[model samples]
Target: MKTKLSLFFIAIISYSCSVNQNKTKQSDLPIIGTWELISATTKEKDSTFSTFNPKLKMIKIINPTHFSFFQHDLTMGKGPNPTFAAGAGKYTLVNDTYTEYLEYFIHREWENNKFEFKISIQNDTLTQQGVEKVEKLGVDRIITERYKRVKN
Candidate 1:
């Protein structure tokens, strides 16, 4: 009887430990969801500047190997109108880093761009810092931007 009781207690403790482990693993997953822009820093000509906007926002949907980013300028208006004026792209995340291969449409022209960077999340704040390379006027220029998560 004592042996049976010891085995039962061990089983209970093993089950509880497994449940806690699963929760920890889930929490370690990347922060992949709708996020907003809190601030940004642009590196240009050996100088960096803070570019945080109170009206700019973004959302990201991350799947296993691919993710999508949606950015919008909210200074224009509120509600659905702001979301309508947005840009989107697809990307891939390896480990804790992400690379975006974005095709943007503007002024009746489509432009291809690439962004590579590392990402981190602390509570509701998600930060992404990366370099973006784009062709402008037949020349390639590299720009860096950092984003912070806001809300759903």
Candidate 2:
């Protein structure tokens, strides 16, 4: 009788632990969704300027392990200022910090680089800001971007 009681208690404790381990916290989940860019700005040295044109549309999709972004002109790349840009790669999120690996890009020189940013989401809006610096490309600037979540 004593042996059976001890085994039963052990099994109950193990089951409880497994159940708790399967649950994920809510804060760890808000970043996984489709988002549309509302505005973007870049600051370099003494100059700050807007990088997002009102005529262009940009969307970014972030999953549990990866993220991708694409932007194009509203005129279907046929207007006076045709533009298209896209990049994608894996990412890691720790608290409010997000890091992305640029694995795919039209400009090959920008690939294989790691970019880290601080992100914050309030209601349906998200803001990301960080420094993007590439010595080979002579690029060093701070970029701030705002996005709204896409609803189904």
Candidate 3:
């Protein structure tokens, strides 16, 4: 009877430890890192179009209350090498949703544009939806993009 009771208690302790370990591992969301754009679609003036050879990357630094967005795109080039478009901004997360505020710099064409959007991060996928207005072009565009985490 004594040996049986000892074995039962040992099994219960081992099960409790395994459950806690699994919960800790599951709580860690894989969103902190670099993500490459798989696709992007935009709607403007009742017309929908997609970007071709659209190579874009975004780096996100996760924080307790907010985060940062570092975005860059590979510009289509006719020459030997491709150019890049880069920008940086900050964001806030509420209820597992994020809103990014972008400030353009590296790409002169987007210097005067401001962007605001909500983002959803799930496992290795990140999705963003937002409206962007370009003062120079006098156009309002709706943007939706999906990114997959690039393995380090």
**Which candidate leads the pack in TM-score?**
2
lDDT of 2 by residue, 1-152 (tens): 99999999999999999999887533463999999999999999999999988999999999888999999999997899899999999988878888889999988999999898999999999999998988899999999999999999
Report, for every candidate in turn, its global Cα lDDT versus the true structure. Answer: 0.60, 0.92, 0.64
Q: Which candidate gets the maximum lDDT versus the true structure?
A: 2
> Candidate 1 local accuracy as lDDT?
0.60
TM-score of each: 0.57, 0.81, 0.58
In Å, residue 27's CA in model 2 sits off its true spot by: 5.9
Q: Candidate 2 — which pairs collide? A: none
Clash count list over all predictions = 1, 0, 0
Off by over 4 Å in 1: 1-28, 58-85, 107-110, 137-152
lDDT of 3: 0.64
lDDT (10s digit) by residue, model 1, range 35-61: 656567777566777765556665566
- TM-score for candidate 1: 0.57
